[model samples]
Target: MSTIILVIGYAISCTKNDQVIIPDAGASSTTLVSVNTSTPPTIDGSIDALWNSATKISITPTVPDPGNGLFTGYIGEQYAGTLRSMYDAQNIYFLLEVTDASQSTNVTPWYFDPTANVAGKTGWAKEPSSKTYDVNGNLIRAAWGEDKFAMLWNIDNSTPKFAAQTCYASCHVFTPYLDYSGVLASPQTATTPPTVSNSGSGNHYTNGPNEKIDMWWGRLGYITKDASLNLMDDNYQDYAGGQAITNLTGGNANGRHVDGIVPDGTKSTIWPYRPNYTVSPTQGEVGNTQNLKLDGTGASVAVPLWVIPNAGSANFILVSDTTSGKAKKVTAVSSAGVLTLSDGSTINPTVGTDYQRTGDAVNGPTAKNSIPANIAVPLIGGRADITCAATYTGTGWIIEYKRALKTGDVLKQDIDFSSLQDQVFGVAFWNKSNNQHGIQPNLTLTFKK
Candidate 1:
């Protein structure tokens, strides 16, 4: 905290060097909010009147690090946030909003196949670790990333002083750490030492085994909409809790690290996963949403994005499928996405024009920013405990989280709200795309009966 001060002389037109002084930064505050029983608001990521009635708590930095050689992702101030929370008899809901400059939607996704230099077929990249050098091998680890928000709750009051210390209770500053990059390869000895590639010291687990910290990890883009897929990674920080493991018997929900897709390498056989993420409904291209339609013959053409099942649902007709030679009506059901029948059956469209209306022209659907339900990419985790519905409203992101107040199975690592006491929770943010996250801690939410 340095400051430059200008010195003044009375008569001699003073010739003196400017003095420098340093001052301490202003104090930071903790956020605390109380909640009353209320109806569950629609989990649409919009600021509705329901949330307006609840107490608002600002989530800012507690302790941040300049990061250990992992590029220049400093913490303590960048991606600050505010949140509102309330619970009903059945479910607990959270609405978190953040101020982010940009979004990183590309996880390990299928890009131009380097081998074939083609689109669509080439396997996806395992991680977004592309680096550029100045013709010198100087490592330019520029950060490019997707937006993510996480909340770690110390359930059962097991963690000592977690609420006061927040995530710092476990986030240790281990020395001689290495960053996780897709391109970099550390030499492996005959013993295969524990490298930063396998285990990192900076962001490693800080909790104890089986102690249980409920981690509600939410992600945006990579295939889904702003903040759709919300999964709870059941975690208890263990110095030995490694993210990279071969047998993912418990799945990624246990914080196991699965390999990302790489060209001409071992591929994953997980179904419904688009390379690295769980498939999601909103992962479709937002520009052109496609629906289902029948031609005069038995064939189908890519029409428009499906309408959800409801009174407002859409119905399209094609005379080719009807014996009356009249346009038969196809009604949209509750299930949306993909050009498909109301019954959720496949109605294949003509190859070229039907496959997203052939390249450049937006000749497909009526909605400008819509995604066909069927074709949209999805999250790899399927559905998670904490589910969200979020969309970027031009400025920042408005996300909604919904989960059962009590998951009943505490053994499965669910956050137990059955007792309804003030529990310790910490939050983190990732801003400006890439892996750079903002570290903040200790926002308490107390619920009243």
Candidate 2:
């Protein structure tokens, strides 16, 4: 086993009646076993010297069963990675490095279309296609979203099934209505009873009430960055009465929710994380500055509420294909709904104003330059517990994360690692596709004492 040596020095304090003593620095040194360090590694994306002494566990992508719908028919190229972990007296740390080919940051950007007759032609563009089918003509793989990573851990061991099934413990697929050819039918509209026809394989929920799982979700580029730290969305999974057979909207059926306040203004209510937009338009007639602006002729016209005038190459990127792009930074947005960029240039708010030609998968011929729809902001409350630092190297990604072993979470939204017990956890990676992901389940984590 690898070991890390930590050098320590102490000075003796003495009163007038006591003697002062100085300890030799060489004799004061102590060696800490790998994975249990007296000094914690820095929470930066770069691999530090201390990491050399830690154990490296290989991480390979695994396909899920077709019935479960969690990457069932994925035919994409498989890539393997490595994982290393260490713990201090107060916090547990993780270092995950994955093998990826490209760096993808753009997520559903808005494109401008001038030829369209209707006003406000700017709309969200669909991602490029990269889907593959199997011999039976079943859709196997689809790519086009943002790069992401996630970890699911059994909280307090409340769900014993997680020890054996890992991520599969919470994945429950309801019965789907079939077609005439014995194939699964699409979800019908206005059905008498709610069904899982549109459930797309399954949803995540615990087996029983009060059971919980801690989910650490990290988006490679979409999440907020504080200094060098990229904050992961701290989330949890629990039972919510399973699929809603009565409600057609699938209300409260899926058990995955953020670790924050619920809808009834109650801290216990389960609510999805709302994006902190730079500017959200108020619902009203379009003439105001919020949603739509007034044209020179007093006609209601739609214009982008905010703009990053000269966002540098690193913060902002213009991509032609999925593999390559130019980079730029998204500095900040104007709260006052000002269209003037930092360079003193103002954008024309006319109905036919053209931004640029951004490539689109759906509207191929009229691809236009794309603008980001929203900016990344820090989440509040327990949802912000985990902080991460991630860097996308030319060939892969380096992600480092840290969180307290015991967070004083009154709602039990987090896993308690203070006991240093062997933890049952699973990991998944989404490489550009939102619905498809590669999972590594039934994994065990044993912290060094």
Candidate 2 local lDDT, 1-449, one digit each (tens) = 00000000010111111111112112111112228888888877889999987878776644333333334445333446778888888888888888888765555444443343244333323333234466786654334456777888889889877786666677654434222122222244324442335333445667777788888878776542334326777778776553342122323345677786332322223222221212222210111112443333233444433344433112222122112312222222222222443345554323233443434433332223445544444455687688788877788888888889898788777999888878877766666554555566656778766
Prediction 1 TM-score vs. true: 0.53
Report the Cα lDDT for residue 352, model 1: 25
Judge candidate 1 at residue 317 and give its lDDT: 17
RMSD of 2: 15.6
- Cα miss at 40, model 2 (Å)? 1.0
Q: Could you tell me the lDDT of residue 418 within candidate 2?
A: 87
Candidate 2: segments with Cα more than 4 A from true spot: 1-34, 63-77, 114-144, 177-202, 223-229, 244-250, 262-304, 310-354, 358-369
Off by over 4 Å in 1: 1-29, 61-63, 71-77, 108-110, 113-143, 172-203, 222-383, 410-412, 432-434
